[model samples]
Target chain A: MKVRLIDLYVAFLKIGGLTFGGGYAMLPMLQREVIDKHGWATIEEVLDIYAICQCTPGIIAVNTATMIGYRKRGIVGAIVATLGEITPSVVIITILASVLTRVQDFAVIQRAFGGIRIAVCALIVQSVLTLSKKSITNTGTVLLFLASVALTLIAGLSPIAVVVLAIVAGLIIGKVKERRAA
Target chain B: MIYLELFWEFFKIGLFSIGGGLATLPFLYKLAETHPHWLTAAQIGDMVAISESTPGPIGINMATFAGYQAAGYPGGLIATLGEVAPSVIIIIIIARFLSNFDKNPKVENAFYALRPVVVGLITFAGLKLLQIVVYGEGVLNGRAMIAFAILVVGVLKFKKVHPLVWIGLGAVGGIFLNLGG
Candidate 1:
């Protein structure tokens, strides 16, 4: 039952190396590893980590990694997990930076990316639905979703505004529900 | 003046962009509009397209791309490192305190509130991208519509196909549609 630092590192490394399309895309991979593969935590624990990761002020992938690692081990686990998650991107970017200038306009690369863009769009949409299923279970949540969409698309409001508003609304709702239950 | 400013601007972006790389887009959009002026709005759009397609985190790809545009390799390194610093420091701190902090009710409620909002923000971003894909420059006309239809049906019906498959198929579809158009 004792988890080593290397176990934490390898777990996150596997998570980082396999995931594509970034933060949201990594969710399924994390679920597979943490919940399905390792049995380190349950699906709810993974979801809770994901939820906490979103609210905290850092990269979701790194944050989630730290949370999961800490859950499994301790503070050291957090360090290992964050490092494991980001190592691939950091190394790749370093290499790409070295030669970025010469191939900035490569055509086949552009075509491949052109296709990748569509896929990113789909992935983003899929993530939205997945999150919605979890968070928007009630009418108020649905209202928030619609209002957020309208504000973003029509009013062209900054996302920060929507986030702030949602936080305030959530606090009020949470307090009211608590009061009612009490 | 511009290159230094680009470095500083992206450094700030790197420092504060929480929740991952996609979270940095709003900041990048602001950067395009404000100081440095290294890239036009259109170029920022293109950068986003490229970042999404690449294998790395969106923020790192952007910082690297922007740095490369402004001052070559060194610039890319500085920007990438700068963006990463905040997360590194914060993760270390969170690691120190997270065990004691995890069960706090206020923290839990705050996350409960934030979850739907994150979904909303992500969904809004997707919609904006869809608009660009369907209506903006270089769109493959009806292909955007077709892709949307397929995505909706695929998710609703199968719901089990790995998203990477959808993305891979979409890429092929985009190429064919682009060629056809």
Candidate 2:
């Protein structure tokens, strides 16, 4: 079944406009709209896009929209989805920029922003938990997570360095496992 | 030509700052140093708060807000376009070779390695934010502890509770508890 470009724009607009949390927070909503609501893609396709977007540059949610849109309607589809995804942000942020001082100066707004920050922090932890369940499946993955956490948190290693190292580690592990199986 | 500068600056941020939105923070800090007019350190913090609190990707929010702040609405649009330009191009190129994209064993292995690392990245990002929100300011002080506890408990108990609900409750507590800074 074909998906209309307009539908692509509208659905992603919903995801972009409504999702409060960042990229990871956008995942479940993306799943709901794309897979459940519009039948745009399957579960595996979404996960594949997730992985691809992570390794690629740009905002993960925005990149996901680009990929899905491109799949649905080629380059034009990609543009529409991306525009839909970001239009709300541009408008909202532009407005907020104008009044950012007024809001920050307000006692109530300050406190509210602070509270929202903490809650957002909690939500990030929740994302970490959900993601870990799927990624940390074996002893090797467990070790990677531990090493990565220590390197990033305790040792203050750059995340890019960690990502590169993980890629190399993955290749070595894959080669070793292939040899063992053979 | 601040618009041109905004476009160039954010285009670089988009191209190099891999690992997603939060990853762009360090570069933004550096930009604060080099181009203080684009965004100040304090403004960066404000941008993060506003970006996270509002809708859309935090990266896009930062870029758009910074652009608007620096140049104007046109700057906002241009900066966003710059940020996403690399992504649109790269995804299109990869999409062009759609079939061979995922089937390669090397690519599969790379992702196998990447998944856990991303999990690690997200965990680190969470810890960093938690430190800032919980400890950066002493606002989570004596009485505010109760609000914090309630949030944690509510989140833990109701796994499916939308984060917006937590944010809303936090907002209410902010006013009631007179949370400032």
The Cα error of candidate 1 at residue B170, in Å, is 3.1
Q: Which 10-residue window in model 1 chain B sums to the lowest lDDT?
A: B37-46
Residue-level error in angstroms, candidate 1, position B147:
3.5
Deviating ranges (above 4 Å) for candidate 2: A1-15, A18-57, A68-77, B1-59, B62-75, B137-146, B179-181
lDDT of 1 at A43: 84
Best candidate per TM-score, number? 2
The local lDDT score (0 to 100) that residue B137 gets in candidate 2 is 66
Cα lDDT tens digits, model 2, B1-181, are: 7878888888887875666766676556557668887766546655666787788888999889888877877988998998888888888888777645656777777767777776776676666655555556645554444556667778878998766677777777777775424
Candidate number with greatest DockQ: 2
Q: What would the per-residue lDDT of candidate 1 be over residues A1-182, giving only the tens digit for each residue?
A: 78878877887888776776567778888888788878888988777766656556656776778777766777677768776776666566556545644664776545544555555566666657766788888877787778877876678776666667766777788898899999
Chain A agreement with the truth for model 1, given as TM-score: 0.62
Candidates' RMSD to native: 5.3, 4.5
lDDT of every predicted structure (CA atoms) = 0.65, 0.77
